[model samples]
Target: MTNKDVYIAKMKMQLDELDGQMSVLEARAKEAKDDARAKYEEEMAKLHEQSKLAQGKLDSMKSATAEAWDATVAEMEKVRDAFVHSFSYFKSQL
Candidate 1:
C-alpha cells in the first residue's frame, strides 16, 4: 500500500479501538449515581459529536486528492487529539 493508504488504515484501526473503549465507558457510566450519570451522559454526548466529526473527516480523506491528502490528515489528527483528550479526562472521572 502507499504511505497514504497505510496511514489511513492505521487511523481507522485506532478509531475503532477508541470506539470500543468508549463503549466500555458508556456501560460504566450507566452504573454511576444519578448525578454522576447526568455528567457522564453530557460528556458522552460531546465525545459522540467529536467521533462523528472524526468519521466525517476520515470519509473526506478517503476521497481526497494527493494534493489535499496532507491537509486532510492534519485535520483528522486535530479531531483525534481532541477526542482522545476528552476521553482520557472522562475516564479519569469514572
Candidate 2:
C-alpha cells in the first residue's frame, strides 16, 4: 500500500482511540464530586471541541489530493498533537 494509505490507516486507529478516551473522560466526569464534576464538565467541553477539530482535519486528509497529501498530513499532525496534549493534561487534573 502507498504511504498515504498507511498514514490514513494509522491515523484512523489513533482517532478511534481518542474517541474511546473521550468516552472514558465522560464516565469519569459523571462519577466526580459536585464541584469536581463541574470542572470536569467544563474542561471536557474544550476537549470535545479539540476532538471535533481533529476530526475535521482527518476528514480533510481523507479527501486530499495526492499532491496535497503531505500538507494535509502536517496539519492533521498538529491537530492530533494538540488533542493529545490537552487530553493528557485534563486527565491528569482528574
Index of the highest-lDDT prediction: 1
**Best prediction by TM-score:** 1
Task: State TM-scores per candidate.
Answer: 0.97, 0.92
The backbone clash count of each candidate, in order, is: 0, 0
Per-candidate local distance difference test:
0.92, 0.90
Candidate 1, superposed: residue stretches over 4 Å from native: none
> How well does model 2 score by local distance difference test?
0.90
**What tens digits encode model 1's per-residue C-alpha lDDT throughout 1-94?**
9998899899899888889999999999999999899999999999889888888988889899999988989999999999999999999999
Every model: Cα RMSD to truth: 0.7, 1.1
- Lowest summed lDDT across 10 adjacent residues in model 2 is found at 54-63
Q: Candidate 2 regions off by >4 Å?
A: none
Give the number of colliding residue pairs in candidate 2: 0
